[model samples]
Target: MFEQLGLIGCGLMGGSFALAMKKAGLVKRVVGYSKSPSTTDRARQLGVIDVEAPSALLAVAGADIVLVAVPVAATEATLKAIRHLVTPNMLIMDVGSTKADVVQAARRALRDQVGSFVPAHPITGREVSGVEHADAELYTGRQVILTPMDRTLPEQFAKAETVWNALGCRVSNMSPESHDAAFAAVSHLPHLLAFAMMNSITGQAEGDDFLSLAGPGFRDFTRIAASDPKVWRDILLSNREELLAQSRLFQQTLQNIEQAMQKGDTQALEDMITLASETRAHWRMGAQRTSKGR
Candidate 1:
């Protein structure tokens, strides 16, 4: 709906946004930027954007909307680089997995311009990444969480919502602190645990053999562990506090299971298993609602 749109990283999320905008016919102009020439070239080949810029500022300068899609740790650096170039009319947003750090970083860099910013996290992403894997329908029927605090004006917030809704996404607003705390428990902690579990057995002497012997259960549990390590590492560092708490809870649960097994309490172990199964079933069905809506 805006005349100018800026995408600050032509990777998975940024590239996908380009594809979505092109397919939906919502934007007449899109300017893209990337530190990696190969990625910028690939996004161009995909017809994801009209022009590519040499620097972050060139991409963002005067654009009505700017989406900073980069590693969580690199967000502040990107914001700092482009903060001066961003006008008050430009709507700033990010597709970060961690929110608190990103919001704080933007506030530190933009100050008054922060009122025009919208901190957002789309709950949809693929295990694989890159412009080649980008799909316009990735956001369709998906839930995009916006963490716009009190300082953000209602008009600016509405502009952010309008853009996402035009892309077929349902918008839900949350506080930055709440977003980080929740994702730490549900998204970040689970990914870390999966990586740990896979590494626990895979790091053994016969790592390859252990991997070869893994059944479907092991395969499913460790799938997320295969996601981009750099991105995961950045998210981990950004949300370390909440993740640590989640890890402690997992450790305590493991201890409880150990105690039950040692005491030969079959009922207790089965009860725990059943409870986990039921909860997973409910959540899985809930996720299906979004997928099926697509």
Candidate 2:
């Protein structure tokens, strides 16, 4: 068991991690800090943390494990705040979605102590975000991707994997660059599309009317648009290069379908739709098999 968990950013992700660790009996105490004092207070009141820290540095002061769950944009500053107290034995990890940028931030802020930092992204979250929304089961059965830097210590990396695995997570490792590129296509671009789709309909004169008539499909497709704006804004901007590349590819496919529609090429459109349908079906089956195996 860990002596203490020094939690920074005490929001949904951080609070959830604290709760999960507590539930798993992995830590004795959790000291949490957030930019907002009220948030830290709420987290403590909610029993997500045992102690409240005034600053990020103080949060790390007597803790054996630290979790930096701040927005991607604030990662460097947060790490810098706690860098003075970062020890070789401490296991530090972040829940930032974008890996390469976070890895770069760790290198700049932690310098030689970067070896103790492991960049991680847990592939799960709800649309709502807050300490109040924190759930101990958030990471359960989730896929957690660890992007350990070249300077990362082997023991620390192993510990990170063990921690996540103990929390019922399926842990996988990938290089930061590969992690960023893959997630840009799968996660970031999808959120961008959902945001754009919502705006495209709402920006029209009949926007409200359209929304009023929207059914389950529309609601399902646009659900991600309701995600925390600031969080997604940082994620999109942080991985813009790869996200933009994926956007271009999506646009090309969309244009091809639009062209077929405009030309009244029923067979071409049918062929394209069939291919997409089959691909999606095959992927779903494969995913089910993998989940079952796990």
Candidate 3:
């Protein structure tokens, strides 16, 4: 519930957020800006925003809330662009994939006003991007994590939760460091593995043939590989340290499976597969239960 919503980066994530907030009747007006003039124009035409500001600074002017949905690498620049316009009463939040880098960016750019900045990661998106693909239901039944800093104000934090919750998101809180570490293992590593797997297949001589014969399993696993490369590039690099550790762990697991097969250890291979299958099934059922409860 705010008089104005300042939206930076009028792309898929930002556009979807604006639409969701509008659907929830949470904001009176929305002012949007994007680096690409055409994108801002498109957002205005699509009714994702009420007005397209000429610049980032102008977008946040007089707004009670600001949502930064730029790439993780550009967080600092976005923050710097709007820092002068921020006030203590305004609630600032980011929809970044990584938290540590964004937290650092907020501290560097927001300075004394950093207490109003909240770093958030919504665990939901499609392989496709852009405002054209934005949907008001995008965040429905999704998990949104808030990694608030020690300096973050209680009022701002509560407002951030209220906004996301109004949009039908399940909100959870954690430290920025813990957020990065956990997501690196579950989210980042999976995307990287999918990308690597697709590349490995395509680099082979029978790549096209293999793809032509690919079934549901291959299709499902590599679906995320079809996501916007530029977005994934920023995410991968932003959490490279934790991703590297996860990568090493995956490599070791792969080697263990390979060794088992080479040694004709059927039981070992079966055990590994069984563990994965059972764990996935259990997790899936738990998630279904949670969704039903909601």
The top-ranked prediction according to lDDT is 2
State which candidate, 1 or 2, has the greater TM-score: 2
lDDT for predicted candidate 1 compared with the true structure: 0.84
lDDT of 3 at 88: 85
Window of ten residues with lowest summed lDDT in model 1:
285-294
Please write out the lDDT profile of model 1 over residues 1-294, one tens digit for every residue: 777778988888888887888788777788999889778877787788678888888888768888899898988889888888877677889999998999888888788778878888988877887888888998887888899867887787888888888999877877788788888988999899888887788678998887888899887777788887888999999999988998899899989989999999999999998998888777751254332211
Clashing pairs in 1: none
lDDT of 2: 0.92
lDDT for each residue of candidate 3 in 1-294, tens digit (9 for 90 to 100): 799999999988999999999989999899999999999999999999999999999999999999999889999999999999888899999999999999999999999999999888998888899999889999988888898888999999889888988998888888888889988998899999999889999999999999999999988988889887878899999999999999999999999999999999999999999999988877841154232211
Per-candidate total of colliding backbone pairs? 0, 0, 0
Comparing 1 and 3 on lDDT, the stronger one: 3
Model 3 global lDDT (CA atoms, 0 to 1):
0.90
TM-score per candidate, chains pooled:
0.94, 0.96, 0.96
Tens digit of per-residue lDDT, candidate 2, span 73-150: 999999999999999999999999999889999999999999999899998888889999999999998888888888
Tell me the alpha-carbon RMSD of every candidate: 3.1, 2.4, 2.6
